[model samples]
Target: MKMTDPTTSAATPDEELSALVMQISSLSKLALDMTKVCIDVKDKLPHVIAAQAAKIAMAIPETGETVSTPWFEFLDAPTPEEMAARYPSTNGDGQNYHVVCAGRRPGLYADPDDATAQVTGVPNYVREKRKGRFEALRFYKAVYREGRAFTAIDVIVSDDDDE
Candidate 1:
């Protein structure tokens, strides 16, 4: 971020605020370019297809029309993180997309100590964010060693929670 003195500048106070807004906008765009893939899309499409196949193959037949098409994919609702990446970030201070703890009853959790569970692919964070309801984001510092990824977490700050 560039630092500028308001004292000497001919620009008005409103102009300075606007300048700050523009800088924040640019920073957010750059952040999206850097982290969109891992945050926005994490191979959920493949899983969707696989789940559909499992559904169709099961003993109980689905009454809905047999699935097939590009259109069908769009119907699969995009996650809020995906929307956040694609949608413009008005404020640069939104939240980190990676290492999200969301789903049912989202909150910080103690690192799981189970070795067998660790061997199986499991995210340390649990998501409780309901579909169509994106509450907040969680940030993390990660370390990979001994065939596992460990993280230190920081949750997005919220006023609603305080209320």
Candidate 2:
């Protein structure tokens, strides 16, 4: 199919925005279609093709760079489940806390401007420091690309741990 050059004049900013919205809609539909195909094929898909798809899915569109840190290196961090296993869920006073998933922000909720503050799956961290023990929130580098989609997960050491 012949692709239109995005640089071509759209006449107005509203027109450009509309075009962008349509493009996004098309992309989303294509992604859904692709997902269906992948589900149907599953194990039958070739390793190389699967690898390329993974890379594409994890890549930064502008730079074509993988958003995730190296898998082996990321695996070095302690997962959220591991952290929960090691740490006490509640204090002696009965104040409950949990390793809640978050993004860049140290809090459980994402900041309006920081998209990376949104959490997805289980988060991981290098280690919880002594200072972090006393704080209400602690942010960690996300190990997986999807986890990093917004940023890092937070270990919320507060009664508000609702994740």
Candidate 3:
């Protein structure tokens, strides 16, 4: 953000745009630094940022002016330990099942519906050893599921019933 003001600079239109981009990049870095220092805000950062982006989009009065909002695609996939910490496994009917997503009907469970209950070709032993690498990530929908630990994609939930 330590750049000369674009208005002050007698630069071309392209140069002015470049300066704006730089300022935006600096703001993003500063936001990221804040997240690193603030542990409590990390979980809520994505939602807050998205809201701001949406606000910016709405503020633009120009017709067909598309405002690109940030996506969780940049974030790294959650580690096994992170998965366990975020969504711990729940024991039910003498079987282990982790409530990965919240929905009317029970979403994909940790153990798949198979004789061996292996998911994504990963054995249960390795999954357990890793603390839930395959077991948690095997469900593709879980990544975008409500209350997921790691952000992957945004999902619009129309169902209001919480079972």
Candidate 4:
């Protein structure tokens, strides 16, 4: 059984089989290495993608200007006094005059007739006074009753620090 260079000399059956086995073994190892590399890449892909996205977000656009939506302005919370002034009561009876419901329940609607109506959920507000300044934290639901108005009824105010 002669084992010579495959390109130059003819090899015996046993030699050919041995060469084929060696090639298969080498190819198997290469395939395993490639699989490991792919696995490692897959594991790190999310972080790499996130970093790239962050970079893209921070980067200036080709037009050198950034665009924003106007609706985002509504998300800003107005001061308590400002909120009251903005949503004045319609009727002469100023019972719940600029009341705004600040409850956590979503899709909760406010009633215009009853000031203390519990339709959606209990209204909740947190009032804190520091250094003679009072700050009230609550959510306001704007309703279109007797014109546009804000109501804070049915909301509960938690004054834990009130002595």
Candidate topping lDDT? 3
Segments of candidate 1 deviating more than 4 angstroms? 1-42, 60-163
- 97-129 per-residue lDDT for model 2 (tens digits): 332333333332223333232323323321222
lDDT of 4 by residue, 3-54 (tens): 7776886668999999999999999999999999999988767655653453
Better of 2 and 3 by TM-score: 2
Worst 10 residues of 3 by lDDT: 121-130
Better of 1 and 2 by lDDT: 2
Model 3 Cα lDDT, one tens digit per residue, 1-163 = 5778776866799999999999999999999988887976776678556645543443343587553532222222344445456554554433444433322222335454431232222111122211343454445234332223222233344458454
Each prediction's TM-score against the native?
Answer: 0.21, 0.21, 0.20, 0.32
RMSD of 2: 20.9
RMSD of each: 21.0, 20.9, 18.4, 20.6
- List residue ranges in candidate 4 displaced over 4 A: 1-10, 61-163
lDDT (C-alpha, whole model) for all candidates: 0.36, 0.40, 0.43, 0.38
- The clash numbers for all candidates, in the given order, read 8, 4, 0, 13
